[model samples]
Target: MNKRIDVKEAVLEANRLILHTEDSLSEIKGSMNAKGQMLVDSDQLAFIYLLETDEDFIYAGLPHTIWSKLKEALDKSLPVLLKINDSEVELVQIIDELQYLIDNIKGNANYGEEMETKVTEVFS
Candidate 1:
């Protein structure tokens, strides 16, 4: 049976993904030449599913803002171009935005703790 996704679990899972991605990026960075571009090696749709959740499982695609960014990059081609200033797209920037989304979800999960505190205040 499909288990309902707990918000806290989803946030934690996202954090795990972020950490894993960071490590992978770091390793890839080490193996690449300085002049070579570091293209993103991720499945966009799978990532989108990790970010977006439903009652049972995380669904396909991310929130609109993030999705739009991914789409813009994909439109040009996958493994998004890394750019500086106003030149082109930046891979690191995209990763940063993804981390931000994960952090945002973690914040949402923290709402449970806040609610618990309020409940104590009301009951005690």
Candidate 2:
């Protein structure tokens, strides 16, 4: 029998799909600004699920061929949603945060620095 999913996990699981589409996430952040899109402050860390609403979709930047395959695999993986600005996604669910993962991992997220540089360049 399928176990009942915890309410919070269910929501985060849906958000992790955004991770599978990091390429799309990167596309949304790195390339041109779409009518309704936000940038993920990368070049530092994979720290944001810029999608703010149910209407928002994470754009995978990988080529059609790559994304096609990745889509299927990602759909099968556990989902987690980490918001770019406010929302918090547990690193364990998405992946090991090397900085946070290691006992001696650097404590610098540079969230503000990255926001000022890459993400802010677009959203700002």
Candidate 3:
């Protein structure tokens, strides 16, 4: 049915977005760790907003554990910006996002596997 196809497409897109966000967070963390801090300009903030506001992403049905962790991280990071080293920096958001990715990467036995499994379960 068309509805099922739409759901499948949404799920796939959501998964892609989630993976992209995870990867971006890792890159940001690495940059910050290497440079002691990094600038977060409007483009980066817009990317975060897109992820948060995207309808497919919102309805992705991510597992509660993962969803809660992401929500908490975003909540901590999104509202605060600090001027550091002559740059407008999202220090709190970067730190929170970094910590969330670190915890998920370290804690999971198979980091991305759960997401795949959840998606499969949903489509099954």
Top-scoring candidate (lDDT): 2
Candidate 3 has a TM-score of: 0.19
What lDDT does candidate 3 reach at residue 9? Answer: 12
Between prediction 1 and prediction 2, the one with superior TM-score is 1
Per-residue alpha-carbon lDDT of candidate 1 for residues 27-105, written as tens digits (9 for 90 to 100): 1121221122112112221233222112222212232224344443434443433221222222334444444443443
Error of 2 at 26 (Å): 23
Decreasing lDDT order of the candidates: 2, 1, 3
Residue 24's lDDT in candidate 2: 20
Worst 10 residues of 2 by lDDT: 1-10
* lDDT (Cα, tens digit) per residue for candidate 2, span 1-124: 1111111112224334332221223223322222222223344322332222233443312222222222343445544343333333332332222212221222335444543343223212
lDDT of 3 by residue, 9-93 (tens): 1111212212112212211221221112222112111112111111222211122333333444444443323221333323233
Quickly count the clashes in candidate 3: 1
Candidate 1 minimal-lDDT segment of 10 residues: 3-12
Stretches of model 3 off by over 4 angstroms after superposition: 1-91, 112-124
Return the TM-score for each candidate structure: 0.20, 0.18, 0.19
